[model samples]
Target chain A: DVKVTQSSRYLVKRTGEKVFLECVQDMDHENMFWYRQDPGLGLRLIYFSYDVKMKEKGDIPEGYSVSREKKERFSLILESASTNQTSMYLCASSLIGGDAYEQYFGPGTRLTVT
Target chain B: TQLLEQSPQFLSIQEGENLTVYCNSSSVFSSLQWYRQEPGEGPVLLVTVVTGGEVKKLKRLTFQFGDARKDSSLHITAAQPGDTGLYLCAGGVLMNYGGSQGNLIFGKGTKLSVKP
Candidate 1:
């Protein structure tokens, strides 16, 4: 069974504080993604990493950064968490190639920056 | 920006009811995928349609890709409470994936509720 685990399911952070959301995949997939889901905006991609130390900015990567030091681990970092940054964060992983590759996601972390 | 739009943002119905959700886009896609997400969880891939005018079935759920490759629909024969979830449609473009998962544009998603 494929499993993606996030560091926290719920988190509260003070404004201007640094926050880190960790995601680990047991499948060792080559591609990992970070996304923030909002009420009406759907899922906006933050950042994605295809391999160790290689990353790409997604549609909404402005306030977030990502690190992938290992194939199974991808981390999302918020340098200065603000009230507007509070949202549900999702992490996903997928195989690199082949036909229609699908992403497998973790349970998600609901962060509230106050 | 390739925008995929879904209609009827929210739907509530009783069990055994039939419903259809539509996903439309102006940009042609190499493939389209449907996913179902439960609360507090990430979306899970339900199906992917590659060929235009193709129809695929998974039990009571039916997925169709339009001939123009710019639209898709999901139909439920008999929606059960277990089928209640947020349905998301994503359009993908074929490219060199390399370390990247293929680029996919996602719709806002349709939230469905089935009550017993």
Candidate 2:
């Protein structure tokens, strides 16, 4: 099975703290994404990278940033954590392009900012 | 600006019951996809419908895309406890994947609970 591995399944951070969430996929996919899932807001894209050293903001990229320094690894960074930023964070990867390729997702990292 | 809406945000039913979930959008898409997400896990791809008025089936699940390519539906027959999860629908537009997850737009999702 294609595995998308998240470094942490649960995390807790204090306000104003910098946090990092890591995601790694073994499928050798070229595309990686970061999204935050909330109660009614659903899954909102935070950032994504199609290739190494490439990144783009999604619908809700205001409070977040991303880094894709390697092909198999993607990271989501919270510059300054806040209470409102508490939610479930998901990482997903897919093939390059042409049609919306099916995405394989990591187990997700649930973060709680206090 | 492209948003997909899923109806019946929450549904609770008994096993062996049938249900239908709707995914609607104002803008036409090239293709649509359905996914099911379980607690603590990422969403799993179920089916993708491309052509307008197309229908695809996976066992007890049936998926249909509207002729206009702006909407889709998923019907489940004899839903089991394993069927309990959040169902999400996404649509693809003119080759713009914006940056993340290959540019997929997700619906808010329908949370279904099946009782034994």
Candidate 3:
């Protein structure tokens, strides 16, 4: 089974503080993604990495950044925590190729900005 | 402008009941995947339909991709309390410029509750 692990299950940060969410996958998948889930908004992609040192912005990337320095780890950074940035953050990984269509997700991190 | 739309937003049913959820999109997708998310956990992939007019079944769950590749449906037979969760439908498309290989457009999700 593919295992995707996130650093924190719950987090709280003050306004204007920097926040980092870490994710690691044991499957060595080539594609990793970060998304924020909000009520009525669904899961909107924040950033994604296809390979080491390669990052791409998703639909909602304004308040977020990503890092992929290694094959198994992906990190999402919130420049300045705000009440609007509080959400359930999810990390997912998938292999490369047709069979990689399915993504395995972590247990998620619920971030609260105050 | 939600690219993917799923309905009904919430459903509550008794155990042994059957239910079907629909996902609609205006744009065609290369493939659509179904996921079930339990409370406090991220979504888990249940099935993926790549070919148009294709149907795949996992135990009591049945998934179908529309002929136009713009829509899909999930049918759960003899629903059990263990089936309660938020069902999400996602469409994957290859990127043209982004370094990412693919991006997924997801629906708001249908929250299902099965009571025994």
Pairs in clash, predicted candidate 2: B97-B103
Better of 2 and 3 by DockQ: 2
Stretches of candidate 1 exceeding 4 Å from the true structure: B95-101
Q: Across the candidates, what are chain A's individual TM-scores?
A: 0.98, 0.96, 0.97
- Among all windows of 10 consecutive residues in model 1 chain B, the one with the lowest summed lDDT is B92-101
Task: Please tell me the interface RMSD, in Å, for model 2.
Answer: 3.4
Q: What class would a CAPRI assessor give candidate 2's docking? A: medium
State the lDDT of candidate 3 residue by residue for A1-114, as single tens digits.
999999999999999999999999999799899999998889988998888998988888998899999999999999888999999999999986556267889999999999
Model 2: per-residue Cα lDDT over A46-70, one tens digit each = 9888889989888889888889999
Off by over 4 Å in 2: B95-102
| lDDT, candidate 3, B7-113, per-residue tens | 99999999999999999999998899999999899999999899999999999999999999999999999999999999999998877644435667899999999
* DockQ of predicted model 1: 0.64
Model 2 lDDT per residue over B14-71, tens place: 9999999999999887789999999988998898888999999999999999999999
Collision pairs in model 3: none
User: Model 1 chain A, poorest ten-residue lDDT window?
Assistant: A94-103
- Would you estimate the TM-scores of all the predictions? 0.95, 0.94, 0.95
> What's the CA error at residue B90 for candidate 3, in Å?
0.7
Q: Candidate 1's residue-wise lDDT over B1-116, tens digit each?
A: 78999988999999999999999999998889999999988899899998999999999999999999999999998899999999999988654654435867789999999999
Among all candidates shown, the one with the greatest DockQ:
1
